[model samples]
Target chain A: MKEYQKSKINRIKRGQNRATYDVEKIDAILDAGFIGFVNYIFEGKPISIPMGYGRKGNKIYLHGSQANRMLTSLLKAKEISMTVMHLDGLVLARSGLHHSVNYRSATLFGTLKNLEDDLAKEEGLKCFMDHMMPGRWDGIRSMHQEELDRTLVAEMTIETASAKIRDVGVNDEPEDYNLDVWAGIVPLKQIAEYPVSDDQLKSGIKIPDHVMRYYEEYKY
Target chain B: MKEYQKSKINRIKRGQNRATYDVEKIDAILDAGFIGFVNYIFEGKPISIPMGYGRKGNKIYLHGSQANRMLTSLLKAKEISMTVMHLDGLVLARSGLHHSVNYRSATLFGTLKNLEDDLAKEEGLKCFMDHMMPGRWDGIRSMHQEELDRTLVAEMTIETASAKIRDVGVNDEPEDYNLDVWAGIVPLKQIAEYPVSDDQLKSGIKIPDHVMRYYEEYKY
Candidate 1:
């Protein structure tokens, strides 16, 4: 398995046991969710913003209006870091110190490049839309030239990454297992409810196959 | 309603229509989730880490091992920023540019103070546990003095904050409303599944009322 070479930058120091540098594992964490918390230095202070992203191979794609402050700052900085996490469950333990959450999280550091060309922007946007909902790109109306012109798309070539996963039940101290306190796992997940069609949609338009398929896969 | 005074650091530059500085609204967004993405400068580069936190009034509390690199760095910096976001749904629109997500997100800028006293630490830890699951702290075994000594709790006095909320339905372009494209929202939510008792729990110990209450409230 290919692994990202650990450096002082991407190394996990505190919870070394839960850390994985495997490229594929990191990619899986990134693909499981479309929203990532991206950080950039703004006016000498760091701030994080939640952004929707799409990944292809080692490249992550982000887009916004041409005047977006965060995207513009990221481009100027030339490098960025993004994190994605899925909270799997709550680990209730016998002792307060031992309580934790079961989660899968990945952090990525990469260099950014602007997708200024129309073709590149279109491809990036398509990847993004399809990542959010498979086949939705083909179902939606194509973008107009003016719309494309006003959009700014960025491609981040992931240089190094690391992921941490904790999937087990409670890990309380052995001595406390005999205590009367109850402990367990409360599994958590993000689920989709039934689709609500836009009131303004044309009269005969039905929920498409791709959307219903998505709902079926993620529905509670 | 009280409002957070907007400064250059905490002002929302984009999506002005959805931006809110109301303290109540921002606090509501923070209280809805326990995990927050906190940004800090690491080796001159800004990186964001997901951290569990609790809030009381305008103060946010975070605790980790004394040796935690992120927590130490945040203390050294003295001022920090954290963001909490709850994804509500996906907004599918007729055009790619109009696609968005329904979400409630808040970004906070604050000054940090370390909780070194045992009483302060215990109080902070209790708030953290109760924030994750109400009544959990009182139900669990109290923390040992050694545990309190080894834990580092940092309280952030929220100086200013801003939030953006998008809870509406699809807003397709007026001209494209007649198109054959399907547009709508697929509501999304984080839910709790049935709790699984720990394998090591004492034979007769039942799941407590607090755990059952949490499950009943959040179970799908």
Candidate 2:
């Protein structure tokens, strides 16, 4: 397994036992979620904004309007960090101190560069859409040149990444286990509901295979 | 409606139409989730970490181990920012440009201070637990003095916050709307499954009302 070299900045100090530097493990966590919180320093204050992203190998692609504040600030700063997390379950323990949540989270740090060329920017946008819903770009209306002109695309090369995962049941104090209190995991998940077709959709236009597949797999 | 005064830092630029400074709306968004992405600067690189929080009026409370890195750093920095987002649905459109997600998100900026006294810390911890699962603090075992001492609780005074919400359906371009393409909203929600009691739980002790209520309300 390939591991990201641990540095002073990326090391996990408190929960070292739950942390992993394995590249594949980190990437798997990233792929499971399309939304990531992108951090940027604004007026000397750090702020995070949730943004849609696509990952192709070590490069993460992000796009926003040309005047997007966070994207431009990140471009100026050169380096950026993004975090993705999925809450799996709620761990309710007999004791307050032992209450926890099962989750898989990944944090990535790297340098970001704007994709100025038309082809690169187009590809980046395609990746962004396809990553959100696989095979979504194939049948969509092609982008006009003016639309592409007003979009800013960026690519970040992952320099170092770390993933932390907790999937076990409740871990309570040994003595508290026998107490007359319930302890367990309340599994949580994000599921899709029935699709509501657009009111103006042309009659008889059926949902495509990719769209149906996403709904079927995610539906509760 | 009371509104957070618009400022250069808190204003939304890109999706200005969906932005609101209404205090009640922002608080509603905050109350829907207990975990927030907290931004902190480490070695000059801005990074985000998911932290559990509780809100009371204008003050937000957070707790972690006494040696928690993020909490200590935020206390030292004096000011901090955090964001919470709930994805409502996927807006599939005829064109990629019009694809988006229906969501309610809030970003809060404030100054954090460590709660030094035992009473304040205890209240903060209680708020944190109750916020995650309502009525959860009462039935659980009380915290011991040593446990309380080993925990670090911080209270942030929310100075300004902003929220953006999008709950509409597909928004394809006017020209593209008539195309023979499917478009719609695939609703998404986070839900809880049936509770799984701990293996070592003393048998015959039924799940309490609080747990049952939580599961009933959240189960998909």
Candidate 3:
């Protein structure tokens, strides 16, 4: 599908102009970020935990230690929601009431299930790593058996999702435009700095092309 | 109290060594970023929404349109949780299993209440704006009564919180250090670009000092 079916749970209420249910737009927002905040109810209180996720089609893969509290609680709930956001710029308006930020945010709702089989878990891990940094999985050494055994991998088959984007300049009141106020946007972006070598690296090992390429793509 | 009391709801189970319950440290983490993921329950499914917030002593302030769905739901629940995270770096390890990210993340649990009185609401709005840009609140045009009436301001008095910080280099297995692999950290940072003026601004208005100061402080 081209768009997610709007339901009571997945609809964006306020700022309807900024909302979109298109699957591709939502996927684009999701693909731009690796860390997402996953919500879980703990002792009747809803809490959010930031987790690294890999998206494949409508499926999001998350992995953690076998004994992770957040993961286990979410599994018991049978369903989950995750939100990823990228803050693009600060929209400074003439008046305090009009101040806003330009951002792209996507929230996903899905049914959750554990990927217990070894092959499924491996694929999930690959997706997770590749999502964070492309070409990373093959460049790094493969996971050891014990490492895979202790990790708890879970999949969320996205049932519905929505994305909201606000990318314009200052939106002030017509009357406020006459005032002598400095209003504009200060663009903000997450950038990568130079990589630092580990303290105990082997002497002859050079920074791989894949690593340099990833840095260049993210660098300012 | 200097540190939040440890309890089942606020404790960090997996990475206890990296967790801090200190009030000062947690506040520092919160002050670094204005955006937070606030959790709420929709159709019995816990979901998170990203919102801009302002933090004072032990209180977090959030404001939105009077009809905001997430804010209303949070007020109805009478409790709330928010998470703010800053991704510091990507830790590229020798093995895929050891790969991780360097971050400073804080999760807050609190009681929520509406700021009904104009003074209280104004204070909340000030906190919110000042948190975004230190000196922009006083510089901007003051809020009119109608604008304040249309806005809903809420304050959350933090009851408990936890912060986890991971800033070290790659932590690979002892034996994997002998392998000819490039392991290190690629530092990540959120930066500010030059301000883009609004299209409909008054002719003689120059970029204000406050905006330039903010850009300079955050610029690369």
Leading candidate by DockQ: 1
List all candidate RMSDs to the true structure. 0.7, 1.0, 1.2
In the range B89-110, model 3's lDDT, one tens digit per residue, is: 9999999888999999999998
Compose the digit string of candidate 2's lDDT tens values, residues A1-220: 8999999978988788899999999989988879999998888888899999999999999998889978988898788899999999999999989999999999999999999999999999888888888988887888999999999999999999888999999888899978888888889999999888899989989888888888998998
Candidate 3 versus the native: TM-score?
0.98
DockQ of each: 0.92, 0.87, 0.88
Q: Estimate the TM-score for candidate 2.
A: 0.98
Tens digit of lDDT per residue, candidate 3, span A108-208? 88999999999999999999999999988988888889999999999999999898999998988989999988999999999999889998999988888
Model 3: colliding residue pairs: none
- State which candidate, 2 or 3, has the greater DockQ: 3
Q: For every model shown, what is its TM-score relative to the native structure?
A: 0.99, 0.98, 0.98
Give the clashing residue pairs of candidate 2, or none. none
* Residue A64 error, candidate 3, Å: 0.8
Q: Which docking category, incorrect, acceptable, medium or high, applies to candidate 3?
A: high
- Candidate 1: segments with Cα more than 4 A from true spot: none
lDDT of 2 by residue, B7-120 (tens): 988988878889999999999999998999999998888899999999999999998998998889889988889999999998999988889999999999988999999999
